[model samples]
Target: MKKLFLSCLFLLFFAVAQAVPAKSFYFTTSDSVKLYVRIAGEGKPCLFVHGGPGSWPKIYYALGGDVTEQDMTMIYLDQRGSGRSGGDDKTDYSLNRMVKDFEELREHLGYSKWLVMAHSFGGTQATEYAYQHPASINGVILVASTLHLKSSLESYIVEGARILNKPESEFRKEGASVGETLGKVVSQLNEQDLMYKVMYPKKEMFAQMNAVMDTTLNWHFGSKVWDLHEYEQDFTQKSASVKVPVLVVAGKYDYSVGPQHYRLFKFPKATYKTMATGHCPYQEQPEEFGKYVRKFVARLN
Candidate 1:
């Protein structure tokens, strides 16, 4: 009985020792709102901004892994009103406030310069952040992002709905509507139903979609009144004036924000590429995405 108890204690100790806890930190925004951040790896800082103004930082874990292997420090931040962040005042959820949050986080981290890797909506935030603070950015990697929310969301919905065999009338009616109503209709979709059936046709896509759906639902509910029009106006103006070493990456099957949207952006110096995958190309093809990011950053050096 003594020997068995000792053995059980040893097994428990080994299990606890092997467990890797995700590192967490906090940065206070200019408005005194506390923002949460997670960091991994070491070397030049590569701040990763997630899509959905309300998205959690965990979505970038796969990309962070790639950055880590390349000796790059990965910074994942949940924007205000997002995962583990403080913003009880929903009014604090504007795009300008979000931009300030990034600036404050950078100041708190004590980084004079850093690279940025952002996805979908995160890409938009990254671009705006770079534009406002050009000297603070070393370079930028934009993955499946767009300047205009209307065009991007419309294209995504239409393409996804068509792929899912959703009725054209339902899409058309939703398209004519505005704001939270449109988003609500899109959010309540069953993962294995029409949208997933069409947008995610492959087995691997189904797996990825399942993961994305959970976080996405949380974000959609948390930020139900996201002002897309204001977001679009601000991004379009900022994107045209950016002069950083920008790499715009899109997935070939990304109905979310098609390549056409990237073409509309007036970046002063931008290199664009489309991967042979869908929206979350980093997960679908991490090696390729990492290779591209490494090559792009090298060019800046």
Candidate 2:
């Protein structure tokens, strides 16, 4: 009897010793889509929404959150059809559906509320989610986020033209879709190796971002963004209804999502800061980015 009790105690101790404070996993949504979700750090929960309308959370997880994570539990989620997530056969990437994904994740995690922070194109999805479900958010953080897709697309066209020494009008055709023109310009820019000029200040950092990414990701959300008219709406105008304190971090030279975009946001409670880097401020200026984000998150609790 004594030997059995000791054996049982040893097993229990081993299990307790291996326990983790947080988890890394893939959770299936109500629509039967699997999303890559990770829970890290401690304190209040903060959902880190990645941008690209189609990008993943990999780069941010690999480089950022060193300091901000110290203040809050950072929940990194790769949205449906992005990163390590699986896409649905119906191909429903609508605004309402994307917002519902966030809500369902929150429900699955059993959190009544959390802070939602997004970058680049993710501003659109995050803002819409917070607006549709204000009670589920404690605060919002937008890093180099674009609230107006059309204006940001124009910025890309103009900047890509200037870098390659070509006229912006060269890319645009009468009655052609903005998405089509943007694609042609982007293809030419990539061919000339000047695309990094618009996305990063040093140019080399763009390589750093690419290094950690999984090229296999389908990135289905990006190509479909222009097809959805709802995405064209000026998200800044709806910011006032979010009902949560917000932190807006902009990059002065980040033309990927116009540097001046932050000015258009109408958050009733907002804190704004503009950095000297490009679109991915978290990579170009990680320390300052972490500091600004940490301070903003600390104020919330």
The candidate scoring highest on TM-score is: 2
Prediction 1 global C-alpha lDDT: 0.70
Query: Which window of ten consecutive residues has the lowest lDDT sum in model 2?
Result: 61-70
Per-candidate count of clashing residue pairs (backbone under 3 Å): 0, 0
For model 1, the superposed segments whose C-alpha errors exceed 4 Å read: 1-22, 62-69, 178-192, 197-203, 212-225
In order, candidate lDDTs are 0.70, 0.86
Q: TM-scores of all models?
A: 0.81, 0.90
Give RMSD to native, each candidate: 6.6, 5.3
Q: What lDDT tens digits, residue by residue, belong to model 2 across residues 123-142?
A: 99899999999999999999
- Segments of candidate 2 deviating more than 4 angstroms: 1-22
**Model 2 pairs whose backbones collide:** none
TM-score computed on alpha carbons, candidate 1: 0.81
